[model samples]
Target: MTKTDRPDGEDSGHTGPELFEHANEEYDAGNYHRALELFDQAVKKGISNEVMYNNRGAALDAIGRGHEAVDSYLKSVSIAGRYELAWHNMANSLFSQEMYADAVGAYAKAAALNKERVENLSGLARAYLKVGKTGRAVAVIRKLDRFTDKDAAVLLMQCDLYIDAEELVLAEQCARKYLEKNPDDVEGFAHLGNVEHEMGVYGKAVDSYEKALQLTPDDKELWNNLGYTCFLAGFFDKAIGCFDKAILLDPLYKHAWYNKGYAYHGADMLERAVECYDHAVAIDHNDPVLWNNLGNALYNLGRYRDSIPKYVEALIVDPDYDIAWNNIGNALEKMDEYAEAIPYHDRSLEISPDFDYALFAKGVCKAETGDLEEGYNLVLESLDLNPSYDEAWGARAVLAERMGRLDEALLAVEESLAVNSEFDEGWTKRGEILLTMGNMEAAEASFQMALTCLESSHADTAGGLASVVRRGEVLIRLGRFEDALVNIETVVLAGRTNSRMILKDLELRRFMAKYELPKALVEIIRKIAEPGIIAECAEFMVDAGNVLEAERLLSVVRGIPTQSSKLTKAQARIMLAKGETDSALMLLNTSDGRSSDADLLVINAGAHEAGGDFSKAADLYSSALGMDPSNYAAAMGLARLMIRSKKADECISAADIAIGIDSREWEPHKLKAEAYELLNAPGMARFELAQAHSLLAGTGLRPEDIIGG
Candidate 1:
């Protein structure tokens, strides 16, 4: 919008020409108001020329009268349609007024008149960018680059334009060229850093940002950028230090606080991360990311109920925030409210159908609610969308296992571990599957691997305590009593209420007594006063041959003034262990008169068998099987009774049912061998015995132990 030169040799006979010349002088002296007054007077006196109007427009523009300046430039262009200066001035004026579309037309007209002018091309490129014509803007800048003689400003502008267009390689080229010409320019280094960051060359990004900081050490933005780059590069501690420096430079910098939270969260310092997020939200409550991050920190802390409000706050700020919706569902799912959590995930998927996390979450909820097939398909769909989603793979494995597709479950879990070798849950699931398949050595190795992963995670929270409990179960299974006790002690010391039930486990109690743990630790376990846990502890004591202690626990359970099938079962089991068959049957019959529970039926069948009522025992076992075909105890019990009665066909049928329930159990195969021997099928007997021996290989059981039983 610079003023054009005044027309030479003005009309000396007219006062208007003299006034126009004086206005140009005033404008040259930087007196825009006075120049505009004289120009208006000259225009009133009939001085209508392109140069006069263009110069007057510049004077108006200099005084912040953009609309008036545009009108003056239009007048100049209308008087002489070929005036490039007037067109360029009007384009600049229109750009200042945010009329980008109109500015593009004017700038294009100016460029058409003077193809060699850098100002016209630059203005046109900027207008194109403003109008979202990024490709056109790029083309214009490339043309401008040919004759700009490698201008530093033009190079920097081109770098920024390329970055806006997401042409990172070209952006990097322009930034590097700018730095080549302006070696110490902070902006040049910053642009290079941005380009490297977008390209995921984190090391180079860090170096460039560091150089920019050296040039402008007081720039908080440079420090923040360096911190985020380090965060993306997995340098959490270094990222935190950079964020600290940024906060020191500007105490109220919200992004610094937010970024510091992310660094802490990445490092698993969840409480500190929550503190930083609190500060961030206090500074800017409208920012959904801050609220969402606060929710995530709390969720990771096992404060699922507390996290819901934070996620709700994020939703309040941005109802369309799909991540927040999914997070809310995850929190509810953690609370075991799977049915309630499904609609939240559904809403998230509605908003963003390709949100794989939401799809997987909904799948988990469906599986928990007994829709195994539907859950499996949903998880498969999520895996199809994100092939590397390890959690989804793990969920699919669980569903496959539940559906009795054990081999498919094994392969799916292996796939999960393949994607993330350190996935502890995947290792844990692999161990459970292998144990079910009777591969004791491989199962132990898998559990050991799972423990290794959990130990390396360094997560000393509720989830960590749960992992410790899982490790304790593995240790107990592997007969590592000392290690199991150590894990139990860790959980007990953590004082998590959920550990109370785990402490009452039969094997865990045996380890506690065998290791002679302190009475204080014993007293900690005894503090569990819930009726259900007390009853379960009683049953555990009965199984451990501590009938007197079992009776004591049952008394406590019975005093709760509530009807409990568990209480009845525990009392009846204690009676049966004492050889009081009549008392056990009377208690079971009275307490579960009309109940059809398969486990209760199995217990009743055992009581009848102990009393030598083979007829009632066989009928009860058959009824239990009819109620639940997967009841291994009932199936084995029926098979043993059939063998005693010399009913080889019934024994083989019952043995087959037991085998169908769990192919890994050697007892069924051993019973089938005896059935075959009774029928004089020596070859079939040998084959069944071989299967039993194979299953019993590492179980410290000889062929006599299986055959004699």
Candidate 2:
């Protein structure tokens, strides 16, 4: 409310003074339009004082005529150049109009004239904040603190100023002080909640919001705040319930819908997440974050093709949305279109060069396409940008392992686990590296740790099933056939429609066949009836010396509709195992050329070696190694042929390569020992023989069986 001044001595006997007095009464009675008419009549009757003009401005401002109000204030100030009240009223008008710089000047003038007025100083501070002069705003707020009897609203204003300046401790103090003065003020409690949330004390923030809501339960904004705090505190169900309350209060609240979706996403209820996100997107179709979250839910559900279009819509809404571009690249990578994924990542980097997620994602795509060194370097850059990125470190470990830098890979994976000990994928990769290095006990421990983490973090998810399959692979290597069977059955039951899981189940079953397939296992395979699984089962039977059963399984699969490359390879392998080498070569020659598949090339090399063509066999092995340096069979096969040819140096080199591929295989160590013996290096031969004996310790291979007993 504006103060009304009595007229000076010159207007003492005029009708204008009486009219002005009546207008002031009308203003006091809150009839602002009536007051303005009376003031105009007074001015027409020749009352031209600063007080009359300032009163007129206040009436105009009260009637929502802001520009006219500012004009009247300026006239009052021009009449009496040092009128403090007129300056204050003008500053208020300017502030309302968002002319913050002009407001600051007027507020400063008013404050200069009356240093004790809280309104003048507070208005100046607010204007300074509007103009981003935070230091000046803080200075003004400190001056306000000098007054012991401050208004409660002023305290709340100071609290907001402190929060904007990131002085959270001071902000909390102010909020608490305001709440103490005005115990039932919802704004005070809301301010306290905001301060606590900024401090990351989410539980305290939730309590504050709950208290505020008790005062006004219908406040949808308060409900949303409480829900978000609960979400941050990891109370997903409670957060969802709060969001439901907010939605009930206001069905069109898009924020509540989005928050509910995010809570569902955290809980891994991805289908429910998609539902909430879809509702949010329908409410606000242009919100890029809602679209992006919808895409993420689809991607998590393994609907990569479906996810890509949602990300595209997000990009359409916000062309500079870097995360959406990165997500599209990720979906393509999931589809194994690595070459097609790189450009999307490139576009993301162009938009945000320092985005570490894009850098790491691009690095993975490069690694999948056979550029191990470039991939490793990109991962290093991502780590440099954000050293705490645990997944990037895991990627570095895998790339280093593929490049045969085993020691570096070990160090890299250790760093990854050190950063996040509960990272299941990191533990899984570490186990794989340890298995390759022949540290079987340590590898088993790592796999067990991985399973523990997966059980806690990813239980009942597709990711959890994948981790289980990896642990099953480790169990198979350790010769724990029954334990591996348990893992296989778990994945087979849970992920029956997943082709990758089916392939892993086939591999586990093949390894278990080394003993004897259980009745249950045979029944499970018979129920599957997949042609590829049947062909692989036939190959496994032939390897286990059950050639009759192998032939019978092969004949059954031949009647199936599919004629896959896997079936052809299995036929050629069975022929080679039966000593029909020429028939095996003819069968492979007639099949479609899959020369790029390292596994297929290794099989082809075996056929050539069985035909007694040592040179062609070595060539095929080299080609397979070129295709995939991690092909353990090709490395060992090349070393065996070199040993047979009496090329001791070449045999040692090839055996070293094979050992690098898989140090756990005792055959490579024995071949190295034989090579040393041929080279007349008796001491080295003894060392290599010791390695082979140690690696084969529990396998019934005596010291004499390894040579040099």
Candidate 3:
């Protein structure tokens, strides 16, 4: 991203020797400004040369007058079109002005006239890319390959261009080709790593980056990028090392500092993360993202009051950032000021009226205040904005689950993960849905994978009420009841009442305590009615400990009237709490098969299994799986039931499906192990379990989860 400019040289001199000597002296003195004046004097005295114009262009560029520098370089080329340096300088100037077409033509002419010079070819190729002629750029480089002249800068230039064009494949090809001949070219290796990463080939990227790092261990940008890449590739420890190296290389590298903070934040190293963020802020006081990240880290670390100022600082830097406003709203919400959070959400909506994320946040806040009808409407708007947003979908799934729509909840959560497999919250939420649907294996895996990815992805976290609750539910499923309680307490620590997770967590606690509560569901029975518990409420009878009672209640509630979501939610909450997942699921299913109500459906799947109908529940979970091949939650649940039923074929299929849906979730591997175990393949099962263990080790997971009980 360098620019070239013309020098201000004085050409006033008595004779050839004195004049040239004085001019050259001025140029060497780092006095491009003065040299330009001298060069001008000499030109006026009838002593014109291409060197003067080329040198002037470089000088002008140094002084930040790049457009003018292009003019000077063009003049030099006009004086001597065969001058390679003049053409190179001209190309650089044109690039500064984003005049790529012109730059390409000039550089091409220079290279044509002097095929021996590598810079001309490289410059032309880069310009060609900038002008949207990527094929031509690669072709030019291919031709340049036959030339005897080559330099590190030449390879690096092409690397930058290829990366910009999103031609990672081509970039890697060229980089590998260049490295074969120039084995010690650190820049080449570094560029190759970047390309590999862009292509989603993280293992290759890591290898290339390591080679480059070995050569230039002190290169800050390389280390920073490598660290971030590793983080994305689910290798947190390696990412941390790279980021740490980058920070060590250049203490002021804000990106490096930020990345290091993210790594620490993912590791739950709150104090260290805060310190890293502090360093980043100190280095770059104007970056809103850094401030937002800091706010999130603070919030995660239980520094609610401290998070507020960071969000405020972020807003100060980027007043129009909807995400920032959303963050501020979240902080306010955590402080027990739900009403205060509303203003921030309103501001966010003003900036991006159709932003589903903001709308979802707004709805959640409204819902927290007991504005169910209005909140539900806003949630619908959020789904319309981004039907695939995991957060929004998960929210809808929870709602559907509450409404006794297990099938719909599963489908909603699956839809959410389909949009972004990296969304750990979605994975965990999907796991809960799987559990309700009698898909214990997949559900367990979802919970495991969600926690694993959350600790590995090193990305921004969503601070939603449901997000916290999903984690608590996963803990409960794992039989870590105490840990689940602790996580639920953290939800309360956020001071969020009326949070779906809080209600569910409380209900889960009660369920575990009562061990056998009546499935009367008096509230839902008195409110909404439906038919065919399979499509209505069959399992409701089982949950009430009277297999016949849920059936009878289902028949009675069939006339309860749940045309709207509010009534439906009451019924769903009953089904979900009572374990009548199928009855709950049908409440939210749209006639056309399209899911507008995600919350209810996901919860339906969860309640179905909890109610004791494993097979029917698995089918409900499968509806979501059909949409997304790699839906971790559905896979986990399906595998569990398959194992219990000794359906080895289905167990293996579920595990395979979960992995395909999202490799970031380690649950599928565990499920696969169970499938092998049921097939009497202990060796294969152990291997599968080991793989899961390896994946979860760095994710802060306990060892027991990877191997079956």
Candidate 4:
């Protein structure tokens, strides 16, 4: 008869009965993978009536499916509660899973079923040791010592207890004792590795992992440990190889993927890092921090558009994410879409009100979008948030200077240098303003300070290009145009040249200030060079008496192209020159009194006086105060008109305001002469007019050319 069709008597010696024996043979041959499959088949047919689940569980444990093996052992014991062997197998699985409490219970049950089993007593002791029940574990180990010869486990547990109890010397001694008897034991090797790794002895940890791997070549946990130890010891490539092997052996290992990603990042292979993070996310997508890390990797790789959307996606899952909002703002700013960026920064501030970076970003974007006052206020808030944020303060100094608050700009720049003494941009800007104030020696000092600041900063090609170009302009302002050309040509050789608006500003007293063609071509070239440089160049032109160039430059800047405050101000400049004051003011169309186009306002007052409207001319000067509260031009214009109308007190007040704006301007001092003359203050009038004559010497006016000359 066939073995399958044999009766119970025949089956006693049948092939089906031999199935378990064959499974055991496969297991003994070190084919635990194949043995597990055979064991399952034998149990399905109820062939042996032995504790098949316990043997199957042991095979599964060998294959690294420790939790499943534990379930199999429990099932075997359920079918036969007195199965002492099944209980022992269950305890082994629990111990592997680190479920010390449950493992101790299983060991206790096994010992109850077979009171003489020393292995059961040993298992219970190990479980208790893992649970920090060290005294209970030692008591059980002492009972096992009476019968068993396996001192390896007992000595290992004793070492662990010593380490846990802060008895480091004793732990080392016990580890030595265990290793003396079992030099080849993998667990003993792992325990010793842990001790060294925790003590920062990375070299020793690596040696232990290597020795353990040699004894158990297929041990993936050991491989992963060796990789981690090597990584901590700064051997990244070697660690990567170890993690690669661990990942191959266990395809679902999440930690191996994460560690590999970190190693790749350290090597500056950012793209590979992002690729590894993608794998980790696929394995487990719910990790918010992983998503943030992935976004940072993408950003560092210059995939800004890709990175920003991920940050937004992370924010969707976690709305109060300040860092995500900060990154989103950065990407938006890089895109030069500041109008869109400001809201994200505002939201970040809402969540973390003292978030200094968000405050700075919000202000800078506001300034970029043309709300200078609002932007300046936001910058002040940033300073309040972090008083030592030198970059923000330096940027604020630039804003203050642009807004015509020169004294405040100087103070802000000083504060900035106090925070970061080597802020090159701050020193450069402060020097330019000092030069404009005719504080030539102070300006030279500031320019020298810039040299020091630049020396301490990172001077890459871009920074060097910027530095040389700016130094060229500074030299030009100091009437050192020959020296300026050297710096300008350095920029030219780098394929970055033609800065017209900047040249117009630096060429104030030069004969070419009135020239139009050179300025127009330069503006066009800068507009074409980079879109982000366009607004600054345009703003510079608007303030340089070349508003026409500003209008021309904006037409090429794209998106809000062909239109801006600069364009309107340029047209207004023309109308003011033509004695068309009302039309010029109407062209501005400012919604609030916040227009700081001071040159435009000065032009308005000129047009008003030319059109025979002195009263309206005085009001136009008042409007100029909003553009520049300290504008000497606005103050002098109103004072001169008031003197012509023979309004003595009114002329005096207007002159006071003008001198307060800039005591150095001749017109305000001369108007004060007229006021003093009409008031019969002859000595004061002559002294005031003398000061005016001195300031206006080379500015194209003879002494008698003044109204009261």
Candidate 5:
């Protein structure tokens, strides 16, 4: 054996060559510390040659002293610049220390020195990948393709680099190439699975991951990958099983727990998903994504209060988390704290300016706070970003209606219902706008549709109350007093918080038409104690032939401090209906009578007609019509008297005017039918009676009433 090959420390005066040989032997035996000592001793003895330096570098690298090894290899390369082994070894040490740029330069030099060295080419590719020069890595790998035996390890690394670059097609190619030679390579199949997943070919990814698990049944990482692949494929149950296996293999596998939580979430098992997320958070509490997902599950459960804290925790971990900011706003809005919710929406908008959800939410809050114009503009901007947002159209409908733009409101609500046909609120809003337009028949149909569309669970909602009030008012206008009372009483007894005029008007109309209201209806009115209610009830009792009860109710009304023109009109109507023509005439002869007050003129005309003064009644009706050309009540009154006076042609024209003004009233149709029968047009009379029959549905007034008139 050569003298330099002798065991280290065997001779006190050992030569540098003997010491270098002994260091090489120790390095081969895996005794890195002893080998480092021997190498240092040889280097200090002035025996530093290229081979000795390179050998010392290798021993230093084996001992995990990568930086010192890099220096030693640099010395070897400095002595002999063409030494490819030294350059390659230096590049590897730099790579181990994560000095990727330096490693790239060193590997390039080695590749130039020995083009036939596969290790040099492979190392150059690895260094290029580490430095993110994926194109250069790919080019260097192509050079190794000419070698007879495929470098499976290099190809696998190439797959990982391609994946990092998001070049799934190339990644899949590299992984398949590696697996072609090493068919049992578990990592190769796992890489292929990852490539397929990135390509969104989840079914293929699941197959690839399953193949990987077959080869490495005990690999926890493999099980996790398989589980994630299954999750992507929507096989949540299988994903949970794979994740469970991974957790079984390593109880502290936080990623497995996190992934299992997602699987449970996808399967709609929110409680189990929460349990898995809790376990994952316990293992790694600092992951913001985990907190965000936990909040999402809670939000899905309608636990807005519970979900708020979880979202706040996520924001604490990641202040710029736009989704968490949006979620916080959503939870607060759900709790009706719109003022507090707006700032979080603003934060989310600051992070993502084009966020449609944030824009819609902020707009709704503004509308709730009475900034209808500004709120409408914001909602328009949101719709500009996302034109398919159905709820934005509904918001626009409400804003437009509040602004008195009924045409615009109608169009917006129609568009909303077109997008979501089952939207009950949209239907109710459409009905309300129609009611305002004096389209009582259409309004009734729309309200009926809204009531039918309502979910049983939401029967007591604010929207439900609004729908009831709207439908009841429309029924009152159409003279369906019993139907109107049914709905109005239900709403009043359901806790009448809002003094909606429609509800009060509906109740007053019902009390004026019905001779006697049920105790429940009377109690509802007494509880509300609106002056309009008391006046209408007294008028109704007087008309029903109960003068004492009417006088008692009017005494109670006179005792109250609140006075209104509606009360005076009610008293005059009651007096006229009770045959007290002088009293009714006295009340109607107000200072406003000569000024063409249509209401006072109509009341005076009514008193004259009840007193059998047809000429005075006709002149008074003409005066009322002169003041308000479109007064349906005055035209209808004139039409009825004209029929009594045998003036069928004028009756027909006046009836037509009244019908044009308000077609839904069965009274106009009955008047027209009577005029048509007088003119001997029995077919037209039947048609008008049919219309009256349809409009006065459930009013106990049928086709016979119109025909008899």
Candidate 6:
């Protein structure tokens, strides 16, 4: 008779054996309630034993009463310490409950009581692995050879162990070995893919993962692994497809969403990237990396102000996230909020002292905000920390330029180019520095190199406008006026405008007027006129002999009735154009002599030049040139003065300087022609005249109209 059906007394009719039989029957029929009641009766009727407790524990575990099941198994094990089944049952219950430490102890007890059985040892190894006790897990797994001597299951566990140890070669070997024995193991292939991915063999990883998916197509994680491998392989579109499959299978899969965003970003599909990252952040808002990436995409779009808040949110999640801190600093720096950017960079440095980017960013901000020495030192320190950092070297080059250290700037930019010749902006930097140093040939080569790099990619080349403009300026100096006009006109037609637009517009007007294309000059004057360089625009109109348009443009600024020196100068230049020298002098004298503005000095010199006071005009033009070395107007004024005064040698020298400054202007070439005539060199004189005529080929002006005495 079973203990559950034992007779209790006269008050209880059923014996323990009958009750136990009923409980067993109910348990087999899946009636846990009836089984539990019968088991309780058997135990209350003084028929309790380890087997009965073990049976009850199983019923309890099946009914989702894991805590109660553990207690029952403990009761069984306590009653008979040699009950290996009871110990094993308790360990399984504890493992199900996620009480890994207690599960390990119980599994160890079971193994000891059952002569170290394979089942108990395997359970113990899994529990140890769960709790991150890898050493203990390894020891327990070694005992599993009795049951899994040649089985793929043991190989799989070893694969996981080696992977955890970051021994990719061993992990890959085990995964492949397992697949050798169990060719149909879908997970084994996935594991092998994971190992290959860690080893950076993305193509092989994709092959392994594809095999795994073919066997078990619904595995979301396997799909995710394949997608990540594709992303690493630069097959961004294919990666997106894999991620889409994973997302379709599990809508809440955060990693898949996040990875899809990166794939889109890699493909330069920024809007799609932003959408994916936004969805990911919505699902799992605590992931700081997601917020950081979203910020990066915004920054890339030139939405610097908008990117700040996203970076701030990331910082809130993890205050020590150095990259986010550095990113915020960079965005602020771009906005010209250098003061605000400095602290964030400092915070990043505090978190990671060796962070070269943070150092470089802080250095740039400091340099911009007038702390040059400290900023230069910081930038140098960043370069020292990361010698191959091309961007830092670029920053150093710019800072050196700001400090009037052209030689240093050139050296730094060369270092930057050497480190990363493919970086387009580095070439642009080299061109700018060389242009400033008057190395026209080298500067043109650098700018052309940058253009090649820019055209080969979809990168925004508009930011390299200065290089384009500078290259045209050099071409003009080389007497390639037609080529120069084409280059500058292409930039204008592409609808890009900046402060340099004024200079380019001046170049265009000079070229058109000299080429006798009065129509082009009129159109350009109308198109390029804006408040920032309105006065310069008016002055260019006056130089083109468009005095009426110059007066109209100046009238707008003059009507403001403010203390306007540029307006005064533009009006004076126009007055001088109409041969009204006294009116021009009166207008110029309204300004106090305390000012030494380059344009003002040049205008004053123009008044003297127009009045035929060549000597006085030469002095004023020389002063303007002294104040501003790149003053093309002053250079031309002095050149013309030398030609009219019959100083042939001085005329040649001054005209050469003027041409060096702005080769498109016809005045300097005309001045040189007059000088060559005085020297009685008709061949050279005719050459100069032809050069001057070529410059004025399109403009509706003649050589006699400009340089006639």
**Local distance difference test, per candidate?**
0.80, 0.80, 0.68, 0.69, 0.75, 0.76
lDDT of 2 by residue, 318-397 (tens): 99999999999998998789989999999999999999999999999998998877888889999999989898999999
Candidates in order, TM-scores: namely 0.62, 0.63, 0.51, 0.42, 0.47, 0.59
lDDT of 5 by residue, 1-709 (tens): 3435445463457777778778888788898888888888887777878998898899889878898898899899889999999999998888889998998999899989998888787787888877788888878767766763654676776676667666778778888888888898888888888899889998988889889888888999889988988888878788889999999999999999999988877765666778898899899878888999998776654467888888888888899998899889888876678888889999999999999888988998888777888889989999899878778898898888889899999999999889888776677667767766756567668756765664342225444454555555445444456766676656655553333332353334433455565666555544546677566666556556666766666676675665466567677777778778677767766623322378668887887887899999999898898889888779989998999998889998888888888866666777777888989998777666545534443232111111000
Question: Which digits, one per residue and each the tens of the lDDT, describe model 1 over residues 242-318?
Answer: 99999999988999999999888876677888899998998899999889999988887777788999999999999
Tens-place lDDT per residue, model 6, 78-128, is 899889999999999999999999999999899888854666877887888
**What TM-score does model 1 achieve against the real structure?**
0.62
The best-first sequence of candidates by TM-score reads 2, 1, 6, 3, 5, 4
lDDT of 4: 0.69
lDDT value, residue 652 of candidate 5: 83
Q: What is the lDDT of residue 5 in candidate 3?
A: 35
Q: Residue 466 CA error for candidate 4 (Å)?
A: 19
For candidate 3, lDDT tens digit of each residue in 363-457? 87887787766776788799997787777888877777766789988888888888888777677667767755756677778878786664432
Judging by TM-score against the true structure, name the best candidate: 2
Error of 4 at 72 (Å): 7.6
Candidate 2 global CA lDDT score: 0.80
Q: In candidate 1, where is summed lDDT lowest over 10 consecutive residues?
A: 700-709
How do the residues 1-709 of candidate 4 rate in per-residue lDDT, one tens digit apiece? 1123212332344354466666777777788987776776666556644367788888999999999998888878888889999898889889889999999999999999998876787788778878888778766655644442454576666556556644556556666667878777888788788777766789998998888888888877888888888888999889999999888988777778877877776655676888888888788766666677778777655466888867876777788888889888877876678999988898898899999889888999999999999999999998998999888888788899889988898899889888877765667667666655656567667767766554432213333445555555445434454655555544543443333323333332232233333544463445454443455555455545566665566566445444445445545555565456677777676523324578566776777687788888888888887668777778778788899999878888988897777765566766777889899998677666545533432232111111100
Q: lDDT (0-100) at residue 278 of candidate 4?
A: 84
After superposing candidate 2, which stretches have Cα over 4 Å from the reference? Answer: 1-137, 140-151, 434-458, 470-479, 514-563, 567-709
* Candidate 5, position 636, lDDT: 88
